[model samples]
Target: MNMKWYEVAKIRMKELDINQEKLAEHLDMTKGAISHWLNARREPSLDDIAKIMKYLGFSEFVVNHDGTISTAGGNENVSNLIPYKPGKEYPVLSSVQAGCWAEAIEAYTLDEISEWLESDAHIQGDAFWLKVEGDSMTAPTGQSVPEGNYVLFDTAKEAMNGSLVIAKLTDSNEATFKKLIIDAGQKYLKGLNPAWPMVPVNGNCKIIGVAVEAKMRFL
Candidate 1:
């Protein structure tokens, strides 16, 4: 019989010589929440599962074409496991170019791009990297993406409530990055910083893509 996800997690935790408290600390979650997840009282979201797997020292997990997950670095038979492949490389675009991304992509070939970055994130459709310019998205506490970091955006991903997105406003020539918030039937673009005012998503505002990942540069 196949082991359940929680069972696998428990076994891994035992091998690593850590209890739920330690695991929760590493994940930045409360111990009660971790307990609920491990006890199977609640289900973890896809994002939470990814974080747990990553913190447990699993390098990668493969989703088979048939929709089955294959855990890497396991004792399972290897013949049927899919081959591991390196992450895809995506082009880095300027804020102005990203504002008119559809047109820019059509105009320039991949070879014409001067810089490219690799990401292991599972993304769909066209994707690109954009360097953050200001402190609008930087927060004083909790989740934050500071200025000067590179954010990866996927055009095919659906932008949901609380998603980070790249957007183009009718009044601006450059694209803006912010957290997307949906309340009732209305949408708003919120800056993570408390001092920054939120912007309403009007007819003149266009969502470009959802941000999938962010990377910080040392130099």
Candidate 2:
């Protein structure tokens, strides 16, 4: 009989002398959550499973081409072992479309979308992709999101201090991308480039979503 993904992970952890607490620490998750997953009390998301496999120094849990996850070993037939579904495909919206996303999303169907991109991250609620437009987010050092890249935004995520977000100004119809900063209870939209000026967030500013991932394409 083929071992389950969690069972394999448990064996690997024992060999590596890593306990549940240590694995949780390495994965930046809670020990209780890790315990639940390993004990079969709860199922982990596909992304979490991937993270666990990565930290365990193997990639036995693999995503098949048909969007099913399976456990693989030498000379073993691939089979769907995980009960969870695959990651979702989100529409790639233009800046203008993203600016009016709330209204636009309701008006169009998934088939109407020109382009859609898939992500491996476990997302809650609705999500979308927006291409980077300008150099305002480009910085000389530290974390930088350069122009001509794609950013995946999660609408359900709360906008926290120092989070990259897509914002809309009530005074204007277009959406803008910037880093969110909260200073002394006051919020501000700041660009990564030092030369760019920071825009104060007030009644007119609305945070559309928090950026979850950034990807670059070379063709």
**Cα lDDT over the full model 2:** 0.72
lDDT of 2 at 154: 86
Question: What lDDT score goes with residue 92 in model 1?
Answer: 89
Per-prediction TM-score: 0.59, 0.61
**Model 1 pairs in collision:** none
89-205, model 2: which lDDT tens digit per residue? 888876422222232223267776688777655466689998887788889999888888889998988899999998886776657888899999889888888878887877877
Count clashing residue pairs in model 1. 0
**What would the C-alpha RMSD of candidate 1 be, to one decimal place?**
9.6
Q: Please, what is the whole-model Cα lDDT of each candidate in the order they appear?
A: 0.71, 0.72
The per-residue C-alpha lDDT of model 2 at residue 41 equals 90
lDDT of 1 by residue, 7-46 (tens): 6667766654457866776677999999998897887777
